[model samples]
Target: MKFYKHAANGFKIVLERKITMHTTEETVVSFRRVSKIFNKKIMALQNFDLEVKDGEFISFLGPSGCGKSTALRMVAGLEKASEGEVQVFNEQPKEVISNTNDVAFVFQDANLLPWRNVLDNVVLPLELRGENKQESRDKAIDVLEKVGLKGHLKSYPRQLSGGMKMRVSIARALAAKPKMLLMDEPFGALDEMTRQTLQMDLLHIWEREKTTILFVTHNVYEAALLSSRIAVMTAGPGRLSALIDVDLPRPRELSIRTSNEFMKYVETASNHLENGSIGRELG
Candidate 1:
């Protein structure tokens, strides 16, 4: 899928989706008027319409109750949309999810088994899919190296640091080679330094694999740092309030956070975040 390319000297945002982009921009995930309510009164989301085109990195950014995580869960087929349709691969969420290697989710906690070593944990998805053990193990080994955990294949969850475990979690998610990856604040629990490292690592994986990523996070800076676009939501009946394009040049280094252009992007996202809208439609 193609993104609206931006010029460096401008602050304006324009998304020109052509008729041809419809063919080229394959939608990996979509939510149409989707709402989630708990206890039949607590409204987590209302009329949320979002479409993730193939290979796009979009982050859902909002306050705690604005349903960012809820949206992400819908994509993973873990939570049904209470009011509308949620699709993955142009089919119902569960339909696509029932098939192996279509979608993968990375949660906040690295839920790697304390007993399984890194190799086994990463290969678990394949094992469940009935893939040959030797082949899955070989694939998992290569993927782990890409995640910088090749050296820790024998280490258990308890034996590794927080970031290493998260890397393993990512490696596991990538094992099945899912077309779309849903992440719910996967690095939220880590320290700033560790989180930053994972952020860069994730970008590398995304670029190399061309996986469609729908990331849910509250950290504005993190969202700005990683996404092609950031969807800002409003509460009191959650809805998409803004879709802010990240126009920064990629192969992005951490030091780019200090640039004037980067600061401007942060300011724009922060403004939309604080006010909840910037005249952008949910479409």
Candidate 2:
């Protein structure tokens, strides 16, 4: 039997077709005819619908004002959907928000507290939950090592570089071991080299942890590089434009971006963005 890597679950196995017979996986997040409006007038999203499977990396890709971030906020329970339904783990977003282990968010900014050193920053969530001090620290150290920050645990946020700060931010997110990760352009502010570095680290972390990720990005190449499927959106009064499946080989590397297959997916995404068709068929 040949080896196969399941992209959604990041699983490797050698098996025959019998064992690989299709089995339905659990849905981690669902948006059914979802719509979001701000201040009763601004239509940030309309008729958006999608289902995210366990351990899938899905990206909401669109230009500014297209509700990519708005949809992400709904999943994080930071914003309410004005119409339709938003569910996480089959429960309303509000229901899961109370459980710290259910969802975690990473934003454009690292948002690390200056007073707390690297280790403490990562441990803050567990500490606030009243976990045992030593246990919380141990967990923090483990995650810090995953992000290549074990040696710098004593460094304060002020002392860290921009990329390092983001690494600490990611370690903090992983420390909680949340079921789903919602990142709103987390590397948008970093330099190109640094952003690519973090992208690789994030992929490795995802492969090992097998966490479902909902990432919002305006960059087409970034989306194609990291996502299993991309939900391309229309400009303001946002709507789903196309759902392009990036069928690039699994355990992807930065070099894949230079490949013809990768560029084909990128071009498809760009075409959808340029044409801006609302509710275009999935590609």
* Per-residue lDDT of model 2, residues 90-182, tens digit only: 998878878657799999999999999999999999988899999999999999999999999999999999999999989998888998899
Q: Rate the local accuracy (lDDT) of all candidates.
A: 0.82, 0.83
User: What are the clash counts of all predictions, listed in order?
Assistant: 0, 0
Q: In angstroms, how far off is 251's CA in candidate 1?
A: 1.2
Residue ranges of candidate 2 with Cα displaced over 4 Å? 1-24, 279-283
Model 2: lDDT of residue 282? 26
Worst 10 residues of 2 by lDDT: 13-22
Per-model TM values vs. the true structure: 0.91, 0.90
Checking candidate 1 for backbone clashes, the offending pairs are none
Q: What's the lDDT for residue 144 in model 2?
A: 96
